[model samples]
Target chain A: MASSIHDLARHLNISIGTVSRALNGRADVNADTRQRVLEAARTLNYSPNQSGRSLRQGATHSIAFMLQPHPGDQQYGEPFFIPFLIGLQAKLAESGLDLIVVMGAPGDYQQERLRRVVETRRADAVVLAWTRREDERIDYLTQAGFPFATLGRSRSGAKSYPSLDLDFEKAGADAVDRLVARGHRRIAAIRPSLNLNFAYLFLDGYRKALRRHGIEVDPELIASGFINEAGGYEVTPHVMRSKDPPTAIIFNNDAMALGGCKALAEMGIRPGHDMAVTVIVDTPLCRYFSPALTAFRPALEPMGQRLAEMLLASIPAFAGPQGPRIMREVWPLELVARDSD
Target chain B: MASSIHDLARHLNISIGTVSRALNGRADVNADTRQRVLEAARTLNYSPNQSGRSLRQGATHSIAFMLQPHPGDQQYGEPFFIPFLIGLQAKLAESGLDLIVVMGAPGDYQQERLRRVVETRRADAVVLAWTRREDERIDYLTQAGFPFATLGRSRSGAKSYPSLDLDFEKAGADAVDRLVARGHRRIAAIRPSLNLNFAYLFLDGYRKALRRHGIEVDPELIASGFINEAGGYEVTPHVMRSKDPPTAIIFNNDAMALGGCKALAEMGIRPGHDMAVTVIVDTPLCRYFSPALTAFRPALEPMGQRLAEMLLASIPAFAGPQGPRIMREVWPLELVARDSD
Candidate 1:
């Protein structure tokens, strides 16, 4: 292994300082020379000790995506994140940065994970997803003046940061509107038990839409469950057994909606026939469901790419000539009408 | 941020050498002092410049799990990896090592990914999954003398390495036996298009089982797909249209099996009654399917934990009193009989 800058410089017949500058992407280095040095470095396997290099240069050229394992779900929100990560990684690659996925340990909270990344100087920037209503992770990053971006918006951050969010509030309202248009006055909302920011916003829209339609927002219709299929299955029966049961239900996610459909099947109540159902979808699985669920589709892969671009715009070094821009984009979700609801 | 060893030492009123020794876990340091130093380091967030430290000590205290995105599937084998990662992280944490997930760039091959991890000195060791039949990544790691372990075995490597593999061979044979017992002579197998090691082993077992039963191994009966729902949905019809259509079919994975079931449903064929179905299951979705699928279940979380243990046993530093031992384990799959097949 050509272990150092000296070895790379010697092999390339170049000065050590010139080799260092080229490797660091210094503006002073000519494009041709920089390419040659980088090629040689990669070919000869010259790895500058990352910690040492970062301490001097103040850059790691890596982005950490802090992945919080879904509670009670081993798949870890696979449908959404896989495509999202592919997009994120693809975009980050264009900038010669690597995407480092850091999943928190079991029973380990999000704040601790974020702190570990920051404390270790693991990456120059971090990308956070599954934003909570009052997110301490966001607050901590903001206070540390860290360069970071979020996949969803949060209320706890003191300063505005770059973020890309789907309008869950609109989706919830739209589901209610669609169900109400079908002459259904009793509509229930099954949200995540976890204090996710989107859950609150979705409920907000659900309540507002009911009030606008001259229907009372019943507490009995609003229920929370774990975000997985099992959670959906368990909560569906509970909501159905309520004193004033809903004729329709809006689920937090596809997994929960799938479970709810199963529960409905067990009760001999067919979705879209005996009970209308709707879900906010991210994967193609929703379309393949038995009754083909009526879902709101957010183009996850493209959205992930956009999120990376937004994050890049926020970081001063990556922001190009226009300089850093604190981006806050609330993307719209398209309602895909299907057999269910 | 407590940026260096000096800062940590000064804060604790201890010499820099003592702090360094304690942090490094050198035998010269007393247990009480080591605990005190570690606690202070956590509290103060003292980040030893990792590259500098690793350069001198030859340990990154991190393990890289190289993730290869499924060719057409966006979920990236989520059902397997999430629980696997949780178990991996939990075990690795005990050794004070973090799990660093590294995904290759789009269209980038596995060897390149492995090389990057090694050349950059990103981790002390690596944990690879989805091993190819003749994996160049395995060969490369072996050639470089890099400490590594694999989730599946490979043929290309020169030296025997650590691995934890599911007995796909046995599963394939077992599926054939079960289908034959059900009086089905015409059996079809749907495998991944990717040149994975497991697929080959599965096919080997399948061919042997067919030969043993005096049943001709028809090329037309064996089909390959993209390893996703869409792939399964598309391939199922093609297999059914064969001159000698199969009465029973075995799918490579749960996702593909689900899609195949849909295709069957569209064709007015019930999976369990008209067309028997079986799959190599990894997730709970199989149990929830309309005709709960007949699958082979590999306790993923526990297996993942075992994989970590096996990998740890291979690495000298973390191997403890038993010392480094190259581990090769073949995990079994439990046959779960259900409505389908």
Candidate 2:
């Protein structure tokens, strides 16, 4: 059996606390004592109980991230997750908080999982990436009185939770405006699932842009699909086969844009030549594509950092607000015109 | 301030233990009493210190996952992560262990993070993915006496660790055999970093297969790149433009295969017709590609399940060798013939 802290304490004829401090690399432990304990532990192959120590320390210094279930096998092409993680990690690095990612089923009672994290003290706080309408996870966290911040907002109201999200509607509108400015009258919008609040918001922005341009919104030009490459690829054939196909297609995300590019290639249609494609979420891969993809920049790193800060602050009691605090920050989507658009 | 367990105890006129039991849904507490305690806690918006409870229980019922850093943007088009995650989650669901994933930069001492989890009691055991040659993480875990199982084997051997891994060499050799059987002598192998143990093994398999078929191993045909889609795409133009490009190209992974497919499409060289492409790790998206991808099955789900079970068993004292206990299981990589090859 591996030696425990108690066994080490006995072997060294020292208190368990002193041995623990040495093992934990605590500053209080004398160098000689620390070395002794370390040497002994090295020989005995001792593994201490970390959870117990964290409880005594009053902080786990860890953040929990729960992933929403991906419905299909389609890989989401966007590198949004990496930037978001980088941003979160950048901030957490300062405070010595490590990110602990968790993948949960879509229909799974995520609230229970969140509660468990808090109940077990596995994390000091949680950062929720995917937000849904009437999010029970948010509500349960709120009701259970745990601190958390979401990447997206709930449709019900901003008063209910703290979230950091791009003005998706504005982003969608910007895409349409960019297409219209390029002298493309008939533009199609590929939106994400309607289940998400941002999906509806983006659609509204598209409609608003069309109305401002005095161009009637064509329902046939709008299609909803998963925010992935395949989603974009699958819908391309449908749009191109249409009798009055739009000259420009705006995608909800970059993954779909990749698919859209592939579809155009298949149909012997050059995206920037025969048809224009603008994708939201400017990722590094966009620049590497054959023609280089045109996309909107959300600056995900900053967004992730802001969200982490908001969640950290929201954990303590707020003196000003009775309802849940709402902090809204809208980043301008810079249209990086590449060959595809 | 949010109500605490003590506050709930005061409000319900019950002991802290009773309140805790009720909150934890322990069967020992009377259902009626549990309901009343729960109701009072809910009304007060009580949230107990989860860390403290976890320490007391001596189990966090969570699993820790650690990944080694890769060169370039960590979020490159690597389809392996998502599927591996899905498989891990599927096993976790059955075992009721919440997964806590941590990504660390290469050469970073992850032992501190592992210690923190154990000391804080945030997790019962750890599942280490993507093991490398001479992995310090494995040594640290073994010396520290923490329970952990690896996704891939370490150079030291499996006697010190339990691992679920593919017969990378066999997979590589089989690809060559298949291509050779199809009357192809000139072949190119797109390899990942040769520094990696698995990559070297795969190259060895490739060499062995070529030798059996009396074909000399051409160093010029072996292009080393990152195992990602963009890497595949980036290499395509160069490979296609080469004066003596092979008729068949075998990718290290599926993401790269897709990139190769896209590149072939761009060059007006139809995959499966003009150039054969084969990738490792089969998934549903392979079938949807323009020329559906021919690939190897990694059996990720079963591997995850087995790893979880092994880790769980190792948590307690096991009478065995003191050095690394290595266990390697090779799942057959069934070839799925598709349009791509």
Candidate 3:
């Protein structure tokens, strides 16, 4: 594990800087060279000393995943983050990169912790998950010259950065199409916070799907913001109270759906039979819920793999000619049929 | 954020080495000195450079959580870790220690990962969660002289380390008493793999509870096993096939119970009516499951906080006089009664 870059370069027939660069994911190196360097390092048991390597290449072979836990985290039963974490860790484990989950203190969250992680050079790269549409972390990471990848897309629309996201737009449209096919015309949708880029995509999918069915997008029918349990719980009551309440409701996640169900039960409504409910991100618990929840399951492992690969390839000191490329890998959710709409 | 140890020492009227020792969690520094040193550093916005400081003090203000992705992790719906993480993270955030989750690759689980994490100095302290009867990780961590803590107890009889565990024995005994009170003389229990230290504790609890009722221990009624959904699925049938099947059953977790329920339903058994069922570790999904699951619910926040506090205190650099102490905290689970029991 102490084998140096010199030994690695000598064994691989490459220059020391190239070895260091390849190890660090630098763009100047090429893909094949980086591969050889990595293979050689592994064969020789050369896990770099993070301290010394950081001084030379500004790399720590570690990435931090930051999360902001609101009250809704528990209400939703912590569904999204766990699978997402499993996917990310599974991919990064192959490259011997460690993942640090940085949870903020009461007052500070992602942006604050990110600054600490980057400014202190604690990691070779940073991964931003669940990005807001105008994410401050994206801008900070970019301006700070740290290689980063977001599980969600940035609003900047830069082609240089790496990002991997779910095909929410397709899932949203498919959900609407499925519900519409079931003879439900008045369909309503719930979305994540409007500030989140994915929420925009979710809304876009809903609009596009409705348009495909020759229905005009109704602003009143869409409930956005913190689309968590509280969000679902709060929004459903309003939707049900509307003069023309929709018979069918689409939820972004099972938590929201669960919350919505509670609201429905309060109003003497049976979710699947009286008011159709469909959700995205089918958690395992959804199967146990009364009127088993029907949801669209995204390919989490692939998404996590793509993000890890992009982040690994983007490290400036270790990247090859196949340098950090702006990659957008989106997997559409597969519908998992259950008792619920 | 980049204030060096020298600047901190100068500002706080301390020696450079003292400042370094204080920041690095060294035991040599007195409690008062360490406190003053930490306060001054914070006031001056001194965020230590992990690389340089690590070279000098052999420490990194970070901790790693190792996870083995067993099939049961997904089946249990991963209810425990998330809340545990929230608790751990919330506490550690105050001390500015980051939590690194190390997911083991297929073949090499904990022991191998610990060697690398410690040898590489990736973390100043390594946290071993879910201990076994004679945990290899615990021995290694102790031998390596690396500051460490565990989320479970060790069987070594030597309480030299910090641990915070749930009172599984109490939970198990409680389940038995509750079932016995419900007029069930024949009871069955599904335990975790006996190799796990907690499993033994869980079994002990079950035995003690039965003894409380003056019932002789029935070896055939206790299932020592790989107690996941599959284990439950496979074991329940055998129990039922026995010449004298148990009228009441206790499960280690919701996952195993859910599996047992499936096995029961397959045999046209009506749980909670035909046979009583009780489980530990109540999860959010259990509520929606038909005939809501009755299980023991531990206060996860307190458990996590204890672990984080212990790990934080164990750090050699920042630990004050009230420094890292070997403490054991065991919280009894609060029973949530439901239809299942």
Candidate 4:
């Protein structure tokens, strides 16, 4: 059961080539040499299966995409996934390479699952999406000798990993700049949770933009939570109730910005007139909203395409670099000013 | 290259087994028979080395999950996909089967991809999501003799495939029941586009529930579009603007329900106070929405587990039963009477 080629070669005391020829049924080997190797193999009960040998050689023409559960199940109810997947598939389709989307459970061992994908010859590479600060998936994929690329950069040690990201900082700063240009000084910002890397980048942009405009960043003007519409709706009343409430508000994402508009409308305040709001992710649907939203347009299609290419080029044992390679490209967010601001 | 064992046997006019034993290196065959088979093979230039033929005799032990891109780009910001995947992974984990999630772009040849998955022996079985009316995928998989289970039922001509589905009609009717039980009439229902089978089931449920209460189903009460938050938000005003506006409204899904709640609030109408609302799926985050929300609790986890079992049980030779083996499970709607009741 544990027989090795070397052991069989030693038992026959002949060249391993004769043993290989007999197993592979090569006609070049002499009859006597082939017979001798076959008899020895029969005596040892040896079986030279190709799959086991292929596993040892270590290259599977497949890649895995690790998907995190939508923060609260709202992610699937929106339309953002279609374009992102189309962009990713466009690149992978060119090489005829396969993509495996792996969804990790809350308490499931993501690292172990990733390890199995690589070790079992299931996939030669991986692509990590919705990355968080100090993501365990990145650490494990990096350590497991698998080539991987992330959709977004990690907070602490993502430099070693190849990632494609949007400049959230610039997007955020630009959101503020557009709002300020509209003669709104007391501006409020609805940000994503502080724990996320993008959230912090957005905050930095907001602060920088405010400073450049000679306005101080006030803690009272900042509201934070999940970057969803419900989060925007829930936080709007609190911001409006504040004693010197802002004339303009910036939301972390487009969905939340729509929620903010609804909240203002609920308060009998017209979004574009009495109050102004800006959002990130300038999606096509934004134009359809009652008061079309003014938001930042991140090049999500190119971002997904580049990430797929990087993962495809980084297949196992292909050569130049080992571990995750870090590549950054920022597509400037265009400010789509609509009725909202 | 096209020589078979029978071709060699016919030439010699000897037993096929004698020829097989000769080529297969079996010692039971006479040396003369072995020589004849080899000479015939050489003459014909036969090469029995194709990967597909060998794979047929060996098991790959991997499953392919061909995923449809979420309806559009806005869905990424929603939460439906993450949990469905988590549920799927949990079921696959018990059997130690690896799930290879593949995304085929719209207008791409999905059937060809499925054929390749089988031809290349990359996966032993396939699971197709987003099964549409008159689905070409189901037909292709069936004709190719591949094992597959669909996430949803199709309204196509044949229902010969194995599928795990929820009784969506009952779920829809139950929403109306809950709303009516609370003494509300003139109910409006928002549904997904009729192109999908689930949408029709939901509409049927809505009508049945109305009929049960001795009310006529009004065409004006139904709205159709993409099943997303914005869809709910945008359609609500139209419903409310009706000359005889509905006192209660039912949403196809939770995300839309949340959006409907926001829309009502914007119209200076608190959900529970101004009008009643009910949703389909009871996503985990529904409990955290400002108004909490009243929704039907579809058995997503169990549905996933059952689907996995169906796919695993299917054999390569399975032509499916004479009639569709449709496993329908109806989970009652857990009516949580909150502020939005």
Index of the highest-DockQ prediction:
1
Over B1-341, each residue of candidate 3 has an lDDT whose tens digit, in order, gives 35678898888887899988888799999999999998997788777677876665556767777765554454333446667777787777678677766665433546676777876778767777778888878777777677778887878536778888889889988989989988998999887677777778888999988888899888778775444556677777767766788999888877677677877876778777898888887775455455667888878877888888877666647678766667777888999998877
Computed on alpha carbons, the lDDT of every model, listed in order, comes to: 0.82, 0.71, 0.75, 0.68
| Count of clashing residue pairs in every prediction | 0, 22, 22, 19
Native contact share for candidate 1: 0.37
Instruction: Please give the C-alpha DockQ score of model 2.
Output: 0.31
Runs off by more than 4 Å, candidate 1:
A11-15, A22-49, A75-77, A243-245, A321-323, B11-14, B22-45, B75-77, B321-323
- Residue-level lDDT tens digits of model 4 in A1-341: 43656778999887776778777789988898788888887787565543444444444455677654446433334345556666887787677566667666554536666655654446657777666666777776666555788776786453665677778899888888887887889989887677666777888899999999999888889988656667777887877877888999888876676566667766788877788877777765465454566778767767778777676555435434664344665557777778877
How much does candidate 1 score in TM-score?
0.92
Q: Lowest summed lDDT over 10 consecutive residues: which window, candidate 3 chain A?
A: A70-79
* lDDT by residue for model 1 (A62-93), tens: 99998777767765456577778888988998
For candidate 1, lDDT tens digit of each residue in B1-341? 53688888888899999999998779998899899899988888687765566657777889998987766776535656778788888888887888889977556665676777787777889998888888888888888888888888788786567888899999999999989988998999998864788888888888889889999999888888877778788888988988989999999888788778878878889888999999975466776666778999886777778888888888778888979888888989999998887
Per-residue lDDT tens digits for candidate 2, residues B1-341, read 54578888888898989998888788899999999998998788676665565566666667778644466545552345665666676677676667777755333546665666554445667887666667777787777566778877677533666777778889989999999999888788876676566777778888899999999887778877766667777776666665677899888766666666667767878778988888766764465455567888777666666766565555553323453344567666778888777
Please report how far candidate 2 places residue B289 from its true position, in Å: 3.9
Judge candidate 1 at residue B53 and give its lDDT: 62
Off by over 4 Å in 3: A1-49, A74-87, A93-96, A156-159, A186-192, A214-247, A259-276, A288-292, B1-48, B71-77, B215-248, B258-276, B287-292, B312-318, B322-324
Write one digit per residue (lDDT tens) for candidate 3, span A1-341: 35677898788777898998888788998999889888888788777666775655556777787766654555223446666666787788777677766655433446777887877878777777777788777787777667788888778635567888888888888989999999988888887677767767877898898999998777667775455656667787877766788888888867677667767876888877898889877775466455667888876766777788887777755567766556676767899988887
TM-score of each prediction: 0.92, 0.82, 0.79, 0.69
In candidate 2, how many Å is residue A25 off? 13
Q: List the residue pairs that clash in candidate 1.
A: none
